[model samples]
Target: MKLYTYFRSSAAYRVRIALNLKGLSYDAIPVHLTRTGGEHRQEGYTAINPAALVPALVDETRVLTQSMAIIEYLDETHPEPALLPGSALDRARIRAIAQAIACDIHPINNLRVLQYLGRELGASEEQKNAWYRHWVELGLQAVEAMLADDARTGAFCHGDTPTLADCCLVPQVFNARRFNCRMEAFPTINRIVDRCEAMEPFRLAAPSNQADAE
Candidate 1:
């Protein structure tokens, strides 16, 4: 497997964590998202992934795009350490938690959106960061409620083992901290992230630990 990734990309970070958790080794093909006016926008990478996104996984001839879809593919292919293991309802809950971050929170605060805000919209750095913090804080607040109120929430998001939700949660939290998003209100999230960071899989997948990390 070859993973075309950007070191600091949270979406890529999520896939990295999923790969590590599944004990699947893959060659990391660094695609610099910002260098030389963004390598992902170049013809070479766009050919690999027409979406011009990072973390496109190539397993044999199959090319997978989108972090969540790639992760579910990994889970299905390597079922031992299942990232979405459970009954139908359980799986649904896990997917919901994952979507809360990936779909709800992350889209609005993605790097591309921030770049557009500043470059095209003439937003100041402070304004852009404030926009990030506002959405992250609000989104995480709902996630906190979801975890705290649920009886099924365990050491990880869904159970004692790390699942798809945990994979999604850790990277979002990492980005949240990078942007100085105050996390004091989300004790459940902080606790879950702390537990995940202590594990080697999550630690190895961190942005700072990646080969192309600056």
Candidate 2:
């Protein structure tokens, strides 16, 4: 297996964490997102993923795109240490949390969105950063309520073990900290992310530890 990834992409980071948790080894083929007009936009990468997104996984049989879809594929194929280990209701809850970050929060703050803000909208750096912080804080505050209010949340997002939710949460937290977003307001999120960061898989999957980290 080969993972076409960018070091700082939160979507790619989530897939890296999932692969690590599954004890799977794959070649990390770095695709620089910003250098040379973004490598992902090049023909070679577009041939693999027309969406021109980072973190496209190519295995023996197929190539996969979308971090969440790739994660679910991994979970289904490698069920041990299950990423969504629980009943139907529990699985739904876990997916909800993952989507809350992957879908709601991340899309608004993605690199493309930020670049558009500055390039097309003529927004200043301060304005762009403010845009990132506002949405992240608002989304995370809602996530905090979801986790703190639910008794299902434990050492990780779903239970004692890390699940799909934790995989999504850690990357978002990394991005939040990168932008200097105040995290103190979300105690539950902070606690869960701290626990995840202490583990070997999460630590290994960190952006700083990646080969392409700049």
The TM-score measured for candidate 1 stands at: 0.99
Candidate 2 TM-score to native:
0.99
**Clashing residue pairs, backbone N/CA/C < 3 A, model 1:** none
Return model 2's CA RMSD, one decimal.
0.6
Cα RMSD to native, each candidate? 0.6, 0.6
Q: How well does each candidate superpose onto the true structure, as a TM-score?
A: 0.99, 0.99
Q: Residue 112 deviation, candidate 2, in Å?
A: 0.8
Task: Residues 1-214, candidate 1: write the lDDT tens digits.
Answer: 9999999999999999999999999999999998999999999999999999888999999999999999999998999798998899999999999999999999999889999999999999999999999999999999999999999999999989999999999999999999999999999999999999999999999999999999
lDDT of 2 by residue, 73-191 (tens): 99999998899999999999999999999998999999999999999999999999999999999999989999999999999999999999999999999999999999999999999
Clashes per candidate (backbone, < 3 Å) = 0, 0
lDDT to native, each model? 0.96, 0.95
